[model samples]
Target: AQSVTQLDSHVSVSEGTPVLLRCNYSSSYSPSLFWYVQHPNKGLQLLLKYTSAATLVKGINGFEAEFKKSETSFHLTKPSAHMSDAAEYFCVVRGTSGGYQKVTFGTGTKLQVIP
Candidate 1:
């Protein structure tokens, strides 16, 4: 079985502060982790992914995440938050051995960016 658990359902940040969103997962086989951001009424965009490759992965919009095997965690981080960064973020896990690569989305973490 494969599953992902986002530690928080919401994360708030200032316009110029750092952002952090935590996630954990468990899979029988190797897993693919991803972070996607969705702006207001906008489709979700891929932010980053970990496919049993590099542990630390950088992504667009100055966002990044690190996959820790020992801890079974993939946490998203950003040095500075912008008003534009305010959105809903989802932690996803890719399913294997299926017709299509099923992507499981987290409940969602709402990022409130205060100016």
Candidate 2:
């Protein structure tokens, strides 16, 4: 079994300030994790993913995350928050169910970028 938890339901940041969105997860086996972003009236966009490769994963829009097995966490971070970054972020974990791979999403964290 696998599950994902977004530590913060909402994050407020000033434009040009650093952004941090915490996430924790658990799985019975090696899992694939992903981060997605959704703007208002838009579809979800893939940010980055971890599939047993590098611990530090970089995504578009200057977003990055580190997969920490020791801590069971994959926290997203961006050096400078942009106004366009204000959106809903989701942490996803891939698991198996009934011989099929299924992805589970976190409750989602709403990012508010203050100009």
Error of 1 at 94 (Å): 0.9
List pairs with backbone clashes in candidate 1.
none
Which residue segments of model 2 deviate by more than 4 Å?
none
For model 2, how does the per-residue alpha-carbon lDDT over 1-115 read when each residue is reduced to its tens digit? 7889999999999999999999999988788999999999999999999977799999999999999999999999999999999999999999887788999999999999999
Q: Residue 85 CA error for candidate 2 (Å)?
A: 0.3
Candidate 1 segments whose C-alpha is farther than 4 A from its true place: 97-101
- RMSD, model 1, all Cα superposed? 1.5
Q: Write the per-residue lDDT of candidate 1 for residues 9-67, one digit (tens) a residue.
A: 98988899999999998876678999999999999899999976789999999999999
Local error of candidate 2 at 65, Å? 0.5
The clash number for model 1 is: 0
